[model samples]
Target: MEYVAGNVANKAGVRLLMACLLAKLHNPLVDVRKPYTRIGGSDSFSGRKYDERYIADFINANALPCNSTSAFLTPAFRNRNAPLVMGLELEGRPPQLYTYVLELLDDVHNRRVEPENLLAEIIRWLLINRNEQQQRIESLLKTLRTTHGAIPLSSEAIVGLIEKHMSLKGTSRIPVLIVAAAYQAAGQYLLEMNLPLQAHNAADVQTGALGDVEITFVGDGKVVTSYEMKDRHVTRGDIDRALQKLEETRKRVDNYIFITTDRIDEQVQDYARSLYTQTDGIEFVILDCIGFLRHYLHLFHRVRTEFLEAYQSLLLAEPSSSVSQAVKEAFLSMRHATEAG
Candidate 1:
């Protein structure tokens, strides 16, 4: 007689095995305060004598309780967590503070809320409680300035900042900036490799050309790799133009690399295949921006350290325009060499 295992028994056995394996697996420990500690000291000033009353009042006003007797005794708070709580609290009870201030200003018939007083109070609150949310917002603003092309004071201020600084409407400027940043990072990487290249430069091939190609390293008198960078938005026309330009310039260089911020299109892939089929001896490649970003994020930290060192050294050197350029040139060359290999 053939006997089949019961469905429940089979399922239970699988679950039991999984539970055993899970029990054996090492649990990962995460340090939520790592990012905060990296930027600023971890100790919250909320427990200090001068801050105690302010914090207690703020917490009570918001219906939050202080479980710890001494604020200083409290564990280092995760910066992100604190701000989220504060934002939620402020958003929920809009009538308490923000609305009160707004009504006071509205009551003034011909007068307005004094800009100085408004700014002073904002600054005071930001400083007094050492508001984690305020600090995080400032940090976010600073990062966005570099990463997003420019900073906005508030979410509502984005349009104004974009209009004033970028001139390009919608998401066009964002992509351009992202592409530029990718090229800059890749160029910096190539420079670190000590490739025989001067510096990266992007030039429009034709007038009214929306598309531009960046050449990180022009072949020096010595033959070396020549790279062309394109963004994901590159079209078939752009690829054809770049190939034509590459062929025109190939004789002047040892090798050619085609890098893009996105995956190569089918047309470009077919063209690359044809090049290999023809044995043109020109190498083609595609570098995704996401991968490039991950690679350079680490490199940027190292570069920052090097930059700081060089900057300090410059303080001791005689001040000269030529000297400054020479130093920059040297660093760029070194970076290229490191990247090329």
Candidate 2:
């Protein structure tokens, strides 16, 4: 597929920006994963270590040697499944390019590619195309400075600033917001209860491994709660897997909450209810995103300055202009009511 430059750049930028924002707003002292750092470098078997050596050796052993007159390699010949030597001479990619291309090939072998790799490629392309990446970063920093000055203590506006500069998607935007909100709420809860609380993602909760969030809280001698966020489309199989994961780490968490954005269909809700009923070790609470908004409407109001500003900015700046007026009005009114109190 032809990579659409604007879309690609936006997605890459937002992923990085969101990671940074979440870490800053929620877990300031914690080292959240950064984009574009070396991934798959954990062990020798990861193929990152072997890729260059293997490719070089293969090329030398099999490629036909010729004088410097030939074009380094033809695109078609380079991409073929031939021996490394033949492919290298045919592709004529320089040593640095080879590193990236080999990494790309290794991704194909493993059936997954890290977002950072794509980000690196996008940055490389941008640098080639009149140094756009650096320019965009500069633009983002400038926008951040201007917006913060206008709306001090505006978390929502700060998020919106990053979104505008980075071009984040609505789907990606909500998760980051939810995580930030959860962290803020949990932190306050900890202070009020005079105890620490832990948070974990689905992956760590599943493997009985403590997530960075969980470790940070527990190491501080605080009580920890585990929450798993679910989208409208989550399936029964997904729930089953999550349950299994929770069961694996039952001793670590004090309470388990399942947060969902979509209304649960009756059958699925029934299954969840039954499963929780039967399970003794884990306490389960299902929180609907819509209901949470209503019950905590006041909290929403308290946080309206930042959240509403973000919502409005997104509505105005997004390309489709498809966000509903009612949604915007409701949130704005909620914010206004909270501030009035």
Candidate 3:
């Protein structure tokens, strides 16, 4: 509990721990304390298979993004042939949590503690964690509620807060939230421009969506536009894969945009623009993160406060796995700073 409270920002570790515990709790037939303690042998004993069936589902059920940096992405849990030695020697784990978990598991394996009793405690911990997460989200939602008589942030100040948010160390989530928020905020605004948005939070590839953000009119099944957020520089290969997705979907998208945080590749930009004729008028546009925000802000300056509120709403809605507690508090602080200034 101390480890979790001390490193609440690292939700990956927490998820990993919970996943293992849930895997064990869910499958009583498995005679293991956790995924790392399981033996890798027959179909009945492989830990990897156990994890493959359950871990991603656990993440999705809890609304985690299943990002690559997450322990969910690590292959260590999938070592079906590995046994108790694995946890004993598990290396490269995040600070403190791994060590704490290791000690608990070691006690159970050594017969110093009862596995059944500890598993019960594990399930209890899960409930407690859920409650804490709920409270945190409630707090943020309350902050956004102007009914409490708090001053609403100006559109200009919200932009500045976002700029600061993007610059913060360890908060890589801000960029994605920016795009999602803009899509959400542009509800009536986009409709006024005759281009309604299907403002879906970018689910992981498992959800089988064409891209991160899809633009479509209400009651229309076809996606007219899609935005894919990329942290890396846009590359031709990336475009090729995207084209393959377009071909696979056969959904006839009108516009495909890549909102990248890295510098735009000039040669790649030319390559993308030239594809207009080849793809039969499927326009591909690449813009840096801030540039895209600027264009959106300028286009919707009349309702920028609407955008700010929408962004805050979306930002606060994100799970701790995507946006950490510290980051959320930082946002509230930034809002207060803006209001004071």
lDDT tens digits by residue: candidate 2, 188-251 = 4334222222222224644554322231252365435555556654456755766676556555
- Model 1 alpha-carbon drift over 4 Å, by segment: 1-237, 249-263, 273-279, 299-301, 304-341
Residue-level lDDT of model 1, residues 186-206, one tens digit each, is 445665222221112224443
RMSD of each: 25.8, 15.6, 4.5
Query: What total of clashing residue pairs does each candidate reach?
Result: 21, 6, 1
Give stretches of model 2 more than 4 Å off.
Answer: 1-47, 50-138, 144-173, 192-223, 250-252, 275-277, 290-297, 303-341
**CA lDDT scores, all candidates in order:** 0.33, 0.38, 0.63
Alpha-carbon deviation at 106 in model 1, angstroms: 44
Q: Write the per-residue lDDT of candidate 3 for residues 2-110, one digit (tens) a residue.
A: 4642355344444455455555556645545445444443313434444456665665576443332335345434344344332455444474666666666566556
**Model 1 lDDT at residue 217:** 47
Best candidate according to TM-score: 3
Write the number of the candidate with greater lDDT, choosing between 1 and 3.
3
Ranking by lDDT: 3, 2, 1
Ranking by TM-score: 3, 2, 1
Name the runs in model 3 displaced over 4 angstroms: 1-30, 33-73, 126-154, 192-205
